[model samples]
Target: MRMLRTTLDHVRLRDKMLLLYFLCVFIPVVLTNLIFYHVTSQNVKEQRMQDISRALEQIKIEFYREFEDAMEISSILYIDHQLNELLELAYPHPADYIAAYDSYLRHMLNNTYSPVYHSVGGITIYTDNPTLLNSGGINLIDERVKSLPWYSKIPPGRQSKPIFVRTGDGTGEQQHPFSLIRRMNYFYSQNGHEKILKIELRMSSIREIFHNLNLQGSLFLLNERGEIEYTTDPKVDTNAKAVAYNELQLPKDTIEFKTNYVLMNSLNGWSIVAAMPEDEVLYEMQTSRNFVLLLTCANMLLPTLIIIWITRSLNVRIHRILKHMKKVKNQRFELIPGTVSRDEIGQLTGEFNRMTLKIKRLINDVYVADIQRKNVEIQRRHAQLNALHSQINPHFLFNALETIRMRSLMKREDETAHIIHNMARIFRNSLVWNKDRVTLREELELISCFLEIQQYRFGERIGHEVQAQPEDLDYLLPKMVVLTLVENASIHGIEPLKHGGRIEIHFELRAGRLILTVRDNGVGMSVKQVQRLYNYMQRQEEMGERIGLQNVIYRLKLYYGSRFELNIRSALGEGTEIRIMIPADRE
Candidate 1:
């Protein structure tokens, strides 16, 4: 220890200060900032990837949803005994068949299902029964019809299941239509008559679905053999023959996302693939890098200047003291003479020590406290800025929808205009989260708009009823709390049902608390699923698919703290009920 001390003492003060600055200030600051920058960049990249992945999943869902209409129509037609009997009758005369066709087939073709499933372009029945008329959506399976590419491709057997196929007009002049095809062999009484059902899907409608999604990438639907059946990439001519997936060139630096079809048996081996550019995914990292660089410069500059000034002052003062000590060593008593500044170095003597202590106290009381206060204020301002930035996208969306609604109104499409207006209201209320609490009336308005939009999509498939007392309408609750629950009910509960279902919302004020209940008579959850959902709601972590439920739970906790209760009860095939009880707030 003594040897080390002697070596350190022999070192010049400036050299020691330089070493201290390199070790304590420069190295630590640079390393910490570098680490901070790296971690921040990684986090931003990961978050963006997650968001893109979720968007890809949503796109896949939407693609399936568009085709779901065609699938449903095919399924309905496949098992329609009336249609089977109509197609099976061996009418002796063409007039007799025409009468029968006009009575049933014409009505079925023109009125029954077309209005319900707008995604269906046309439905045609092909039969080899020579007695039937060849017109009015019923084509005789003659040489031309039999020689069609899609017809020959159907596997020969008793196997009867709907399959999705892209068919053209035989000539290469027009675009191919995506269709669902199924053989009508379900009835056992068929006397060797070949029956085929084809439901042509609206290509424009499918394209619109792809266009409406706010995903940053090219989307492709690949069949089992890796052939691109449908694509949003404008470079490829969709009107041409099916392109091999590998032949399509993507961006050099791209991230690919893929999701396979599981629910639709007809689309068993089909997959949705998305090619997103790396730059698009990590676009925000450039801003983050610039901010980090600026912060690092500020962090380094302030500490460097402070350290240089402090070290210089210490070196000069200590050098003078050392010179006086050396003079005293030559047999002369000498007192060091200088006006000492109020610092740690000044604490070496009696009066100087008292002044130094006073200065230290003043710094702790004023300067340090002021710095902490400013830091808090800066943090508060940053939060406010972030909130404002978050609102920008929603406001922009709302304005765009308003413009679309006005255009629709000008075109005299009242129904479309009304739906767009409801959609706009939903986007505004749900996304622009400017407040923590909203009156029950305002929340109900948002829910009403949301339900209206859903009704437009589902038509008569979705039913809703709201029961609330007039007095309860004025009660306050967390914004979107009820709407989130209603959405969950609509999507998870009602959406999966074949015939669809009803959603009921009830609001009651009892004692000093408010009770809000959202129930759906759709497909429900099992006991274990309910337990898992409860556990998920109780968790303080982010969830991917159940984010809506988590958001509602989080907001309730934020607004009411521990003074809120949420209860979920469900049974498979019976539907679900979510009830919430919170202290009534009038302010």
Candidate 2:
């Protein structure tokens, strides 16, 4: 039973635990969501419906205000005495009546509509004989007007009864192509007889009014027959009052939408109705809803995430502490950042810091002891190297001197004496083996001895030249550097050639660099051997021991680092050229 429970616990760890933790936090949130759906949505819906009703009332008020202004302007043609006489003259003598007509027009447009109504296309005063008066005139009578549904509704004579007509202006605004018209009885005295004149009104001037209303949801202007006389939209099924209001027997007199909108037509003659969308009505509420959602989601999710993160962070820190303790058991002194506070984590890190410090002190003592031992070993090895070198140098010098003495005793003395003197000089330089550095002049003298010995062995078969600037001789250089190079050329390079070869050593200073080159006309190395020499130079830097070429490379790097370069160019039959560059030394 215990094992089964432990296995189950293990299976429930990690992501499973994290998911369960999130679910535990989610339960209350789900319940709250349910409560919100029950309580708040009802209140929100009611609020939206009430707001939509108020918006519809406001729209009705706006339209009524527009209708009132249009009536007042149309009433002017009936009441204003001078304007009527001007319109009569402007009709027949349209060209000659400019000043009178202009004054009439300026007055006609000014009082026609409210400032909010910019849709006044033009105001027309039509007389009993179809005489039309218009400002900014384009004839409203077009072929399409004869075919309009409202055009045939006009009575035979311009009667006193109120009549409405929709006549197109011939321009291609399909929905707004038609203008609203009203006919009224005009009464005046002419030649002392009672003259009954007919007056006509075209409310194309209201087009600008429709342009401003927001028309997205539902906008309709109804006639008394429940027919849509003029609407912002054409497809509103003007005669079907059922579609606009969802009721059969629509009101010729009332304003209502979905039992919410309640603005009735205040004027029985002509009225315009607009139904503002529910979304547009309560646009401000939508922003409040979004803000609530964001604020609620953040308030809920933040704490849950922080709690889960804290637990996971604690687990990570514990794992680091365990790993550090394991490393300590194995006796490693390493720096690990401690938990840097007085909290539980901080206390654990403090203990770890003490352990690491103690381990470091113990390691330091052991390291110092080991260093002393290494220094002693290095001193012993250096002593052995010095003793071996001392024996080797004298042995070589004694043999070379004895060979020169024998040669002198046998026959030649001049060149052999010179060779012996060079040998003595080489011996004198080698005695300063305690010093790691020597002058280039000393190394060149050593090279002279080495070459003299080689020349003696090879005779005229080997030939060489040395060209050096005088300033280059006193430069500090590694001891025996020139001797090793000359020995390498003579032993490995020249001696291998059948007829022997010429070697040249030249030194120059160019462009902040000291350049020394050695060229040989002997049998040269293959590409593979050249690569191996390059590898030998590299290995000495990685490992501090040098067998041959590595020693020269080490000495150059020890002094110059990146400021030195050794480049070798060689081909099988064409021989070899080695160029060494060192940065010009100031001190």
Candidate 3:
């Protein structure tokens, strides 16, 4: 059993379906045909038996009718007073008596008894009247008649009742006849004048009643004692040793003896045994059975072929899906061909196709996005370096310094060297723009340098303070992100104010994110301007204003993706506060 299970484990779905169809369809059909043939066989046996039984009953009626006719004749003869008187009367001579008796006998036999009963072969009468003449139909009573075997069959007190006898070796050249014998007494004479009447019947005439019955099997007529009285089959043993009824082992509705025929009993205690050889009955059934089997096999064949076709179709579709799945496993995401049907498998195929397309799109989106992200990071670093390099352009610097420092330093010679040295330090730090990120301490130093120069420019009017934890000063941030916010406060917020405002810068870590806020009490913008700046920073759709803040927002987005958050809050006549949040990376 384990081996069988193991073997079956390797069998594919197609083969399993084929095996299931054979068990579910073919085997049942074969069994049904066998059952039907068996039932048909039994019905055939019973129907044949019924037919033979009916024929046997008809033959019985004919036998009884023959005897009934003989009895009627005896009744007529017993009541005939004239004939009785003529036989009893004394005659002058034997010739005169012979003429009277012969005349009466000829008229009775030829015109009355014989004409009425066609089965009667002959009628004979014997009387003890010595004067009566003997003729063809009449006989003189012999003294030895008392010793005949038929004499013992007559009832002692039954003078008019008939009795049947099978006469053996009779006084004629013909075969043995079945006779009816009775005593005749017309009048109650004091001497009790008695006569014997015998009516003979031809066996051929009785057998002729059933001769033309169209039957294939043997038909039997049994007596009341279950003896085989007569049969259409001459080969049957009809001796004195009677064949018992029960020994035949006949079939009722079911044929127990497949090889033997059946004997059925009739209403008259006589069994009508009709039997055909089992081979012959089965032979007839076999022909019909073969026809039925052919039809059954033909019927089963069509569905089996249909099942095979259906299984093959399913196999094709399923195999195609499996093959496509194999390719998907190998990372080749391709849509499978859709089926025209709306069944489950077809729906599954459609879903698979949709899933493959979705996966491909996701993969492509991720791949392209990664490439673009790397390119943006490179551009951000290069643009920051270029901006730093362009800040110290010799032509612009030389012209600006020549014009501003020559005039301003002559007026304020004390602040001139301090501003130049701070400017130089800021420029020197900005020049090292190749690094993608800087420590918060270095960023703070750059902010301080710019703020000190701003103090030189707007000493007491513009003031600033920096508050940060020493531990937070070592944290990393994108290069120039903090410095840009400080520069923007000094140039845009404080420069525009008539009374320059103070700038407060705070850096801290909150919940593993960097919090940087730059608040200034400067000439703050209106809500509309703030909204426009916010929109530019968030959406990057408006490109013409606040280029510094926009550049800071864009760089932060590029460096940290969406993990950073920036917001600005300001109002007319109020200071602006820019708050930035970034992931706290402390290396």
Candidate 4:
């Protein structure tokens, strides 16, 4: 029974009891919160999707109109059959060329033609062993057929067919010109030889088609030739951060189908890929989130006030028990009066006081002797710093890191392991005793540690990228200030996410300022949360536990004299990036 009581007490009774209370309280709150939030988000997501889809549908109207117009023009060219008959009659005639050309012009004038958005540049018919000179001072009949797409693949003695043309510079694959091809039969001369007509098309309307979308970010049209006919903006800053484009297993030569909501779109052997500034979506969502958050915040405070009231009342009872405890501390345990209050804290502390009183009555003299026996140990060894630093071997921490790494590996999480190992290396430095200031390398390692832990905790719901130089790692930083953010991200930002997000960490040297950043791909904080961070930093002005962001912020003020700047950028469910500037000093 004694051992059972000891085990239960050591098993963390306060936390376990609090956890039971919290689970009962938080579970209902979370379910209600989640259900309400999910309904709101679903409606918003569906509305946004429908809005975007409506825009796509509107673009399709233009597509059908353009295609119908092109087909209608093709019909007109077919009906203007006299131009083909002129070339047929003009064939094998030199002086007849003037008469034949005049007939062709007369026929062209009779045809109805409207302005084309991107029309055939001009039509020309070629005849073998034929001669005709016109107003241009050039004869189309004598011109030899050179390079044309499907020129050879085309079947002989058949109607002209649509040709797949490429826009090329015609010089090298490195220097290519933009071109479009559309082919049809205008005329074929009657003889052993054949004269055929073709049109070289200009895609000016294609430009207008893309432009009308008035998209906000990168928009492109990719056709079967891996040709990018249009791009509103080009990517030059970062190469595809995941894989080389050529190495990607993306759908070959077409984006006609897509499974991911945020993936490329394919249509008409051409796909339109668009990326709008995510900030816009987040900005819009913020308006609603602010309202919800205001309510959430209002609701969240009520419980907090209640919990505070409960904690205060509980603390009062605890203080009463402690008052009796202090009196007994000067001597041996002495019995104290038990409280009439039936509350849990009152009962528990009352029992504790009673037990101490009994022990004092039984072992006052013996306990006094035992106290003297331990005095020599404290007097002979007062090296608490050495003991505190050295006694805590990093073996446990390394093992913890190793456990996380090995577990991630077994689960086939390579990226996760990379992050975890990086974090572990940072902790290796952190736990080292007698280390007041870590170099930039060590500081960076610390940041890496925090990032990996966060990356693991967040999973694919978050993305992260880091850019840093080795020189910066040698600069001194207050230990663990950056690392504390990892915990902050988990405890504060990420705890609310329904689907996870991205973090970007960047360091640069600019105008003597050493810039450090930590960003997260989690549901971002409310303005209140953002405001609370400042309060948290101030709250750290009071002594606190070593486990959270407040503790780390405290250390930062100690080292940097509060002259540092921490700039933040974020949106709900969008993500966050924090950039901090500090003077670079190596010691």
Candidate 5:
């Protein structure tokens, strides 16, 4: 079953559809034709059997007439008074008795009964009387009479009923002639005499019944035990070699005619059976079958061919659409041509064409729009840097000038010159805002210059430290991004303490990400204040302020999308820590 399922799964839709059609149409048609042939053949066979039976009946009628004539002659002789008296009278002399019997026999054989029926051959009388002579139509009974097969069968109670037997050759030959025998009895005289009358019929009488009969079959005349008495087939000699009814090997079709209906006073269970071969009986049916098969083939072939053609034509169009969809999967948008028909496949093709066009247009529009948007974002970040740098420049110059004036009054000319140089370098970095990005080393150098200026202004009260891996020094970030974070921690957290606090700047690499932290120990701000500042950074919006930190957050968002992270931690009188994480692989 699993193998069958796998085979079906691999089969294409066209083959599956064809298989479905075969089951729905051709298989049923073949089955129906088989059923039709079976039913028709059965009906034809039954009809042929009926025809054979009717023919047998007609033959039966013709043969029974001959048998009836023989029966009629026997009945007439049973009541013949003259013939009986002649046999009963006592003869005083042998010559006179013989002469009297010859005259009576001649009269009966030549004029009385023989003239009535032409089928009878000869009639003879066998008697035990001593006066009777063994002449023509007369025989004296002796030892041979008791030895005869019909001698014991003759009725002895004066019934005068006839019995049929085969008469052997009188000269002891094996040739037989059919005969009927009857026992004769005295009516009045007490002569203690007995006589047996035998009438032989010509064998030609039985042969004439079968001659020129219009039938091609075998015929059997069966006797009391259903044994064959006679058969029209010359090959069968039932008298010498008998055959039983069941052993006849009769054909499938047969008809039987019984002798009881054909012969009056018939005591034997005799029947005339006729059998014809099945092939002969069903000749017409075979012709009809051949013609039906031809018609069925023509019927099945033409339509099946036409249906397959149509199925393939429809599938071809569907497969064409499938090929187009495959090309679309590879981003090759091409249209199907001349597919606008009224059918469902045509409609699908039209819809597919339209969809490909829409997809192509959508991709082009989004592509151009995305490039333009990236250019505008870069220009905006550069503008924000310039504006922020220009705004912080004058404030830094005022603080540096005041620090230089204080150092000069204390007579520290070298420190004043160093402060001036650091301030000048800070201004130089601010002026070069054309490049939106710089290496971490460059940004750290600028941060160092800013810290030196601040240290000169605050003296030993303000201390700071910077630590970073040498490998991280070459990593690129937006210009002054680190500097802004350090500046914010100093101004907001460290400078608020009366005893100035220390600021620490650390750069490290962790888990393929760059981490920059700026921490200060001073009077820390409240949680509410830190929360507000972090929310403002996330929203990138503010009403009354455009702080440098906000600018840094916005530029970081633009450069790295969502790949950078910033976190601020602060508490009252403890410290503030700001940690920023960015992708290590960033430019």
Candidate 6:
């Protein structure tokens, strides 16, 4: 997890924006378009299959209608007593049969059932009467007639109902015609001659019915054995002999739709099959697919271009800002030279320019002047310290205090000797100006020495306590800063009280800052006086005092700048409390 954050931190803004675009925009658009294309193509394919199914059903209806008409004609002839009599009549001469045929069979051919039933080409009756003429719709059932394919293939039990069959030579070289044949035995004859009725169906009419359907693919009438009895496929000849369904070389991706012939007894298990290539079934989807692709491209292209433009704009502006920021390290406060826009980056650019200008002015007008002033102040302070040191030699002073302390101890004045010892230590610390910073522990020691000397002067009237954490003792601060505050509290707050007072000094570290609080239970000031003291602390001007509260405030200001804080609270008849806060120096 840390490694990913580190890697991303180093990546440029432009590349990051592009990555976002790829994830949030590009992938989703592509997936959506793909799903849309798949769904649309599937729907189109299914609709095509349905249309083919409907076309095959239509073919079945037309096929049965034609066969039904032929059956009707055969039924009419089955009960025709006149036609039966004509076939059963005996003829002694060919001339007599010709007279009978001219009167009945020829008239029947010209004006009867054939004219009414247009689906049939002609109706012929075959009989085993050798006396009948063979010229007029009647053929003598000799051995040759009995040997025909259609006659020999009839089922014996099918004599009661009309039967449908294809009438052609055994060889598949020529077109075949369909016929309905029935045994005409409704009326018994004296001669007991077997008779058959054959109605030849019109092949041209059936072919026209198939062609007019105008389907997109091949259509076939398959028999019970899966043989192609008839087809509207241009590749197969309609007039040719039947072929096995599997023998045709269909397309590899062909789709077939089949509907069975349910209403006709002769056509049981037969079906009309439609075969269409997969490409043809989905032909219209080609245009739709291209449109979807083009739409997908359009969807992706515009946004990608937009992302590029936006990323480029952001990268260029941000890079310019970064370049200017680098120049700032070399103290080159140059303003960015461009028309600032109203966007967030533009606002950032505007803010940066203002900050640069302010920094440049500060360096020229305030920073250099403040450094020179601080230098002169340090020199004056050092000179004053040197004059004081010249006046009071530190070695002579320490030796004189030691001599006085030994005399007091020799006379058995142990308390006086201790007072002299603490005074010597205070003088030693006051003379040292080489180190301006000291640890809290060292500063507290100096304050203890000064407090001890004051205690000697006031005896039982003055009381003081110093509280501090062991860990907080190492924090560095301006030398004598806390001592000065403690001294002020003792002299001004405690010394004025008749019964005397107690001074408490506490040191603490909190929230990366050092806190030094001094409270005195002595004479307190009014609110107005406390407010006046606060005003004095805030001012940079010198207060005409030596090593007092103002001195401590000034020294803290120089050390910690505006980061240090001071608060003074005093109330009439109550103690005064002073709190000082500064940044802690752990090192």
TM-scores for all candidates? 0.51, 0.46, 0.46, 0.39, 0.51, 0.56
User: Predicted candidate 6: what Cα RMSD to the true structure?
Assistant: 11.2
TM-score of 5: 0.51
lDDT of each: 0.80, 0.59, 0.72, 0.55, 0.74, 0.81
Q: Is candidate 3 or candidate 4 better by TM-score?
A: 3
Residue-by-residue lDDT tens digits, candidate 3, 22-95: 89988888888888878886777566556555655566566667767877787788778877776567677988
TM-score of the candidate numbered 6? 0.56
Give the lDDT of residue 232 in candidate 4: 50
lDDT of 5: 0.74
Q: Which stretches of candidate 4 lie over 4 Å from their true place?
A: 1-21, 24-27, 30-64, 91-129, 134-145, 148-155, 167-188, 192-202, 212-298, 321-587
TM-score of 2: 0.46
Q: Would you list the clashing residue pairs of candidate 2?
A: 119-208
What digit string (tens of lDDT, one per residue) describes model 2 on residues 1-587?
99977866777245655666667666666566556654565577667666655555565566555545445545555566675454443245545455664666565545544354444344544333223434443133445644656556665564543333444433454333333345433645342211122122224544444545443445565655455555565545543323433333433443334221233322464444555555665455566566556756866787778767977767677677778888878876565674376779768878887879987888877998999999998786567456544544564666667677677757867777776767667776676677866666766767767778778879888998998778877666556655666667777778887785788888677897777787888788899988987876565334233435555665566556677888989888778888888866533
Error of model 6, residue 51, in angstroms: 1.5
Among residues 3 or more apart in sequence or in different chains, the pairs in candidate 3 whose N, CA or C atoms overlap within 3 Å are: none
What is the lDDT for 379 in model 2?
A: 89
- Residues 353-453 of candidate 4 have per-residue lDDT tens digits of 77786776678668777888789665533343233333333457877988989999999999878887886776576566677566667666666666566
lDDT of 6 at 239: 42
Supply the global lDDT for candidate 3.
Answer: 0.72
TM-score of 3: 0.46
Can you rank all candidates by TM-score, best first? 6, 1, 5, 3, 2, 4
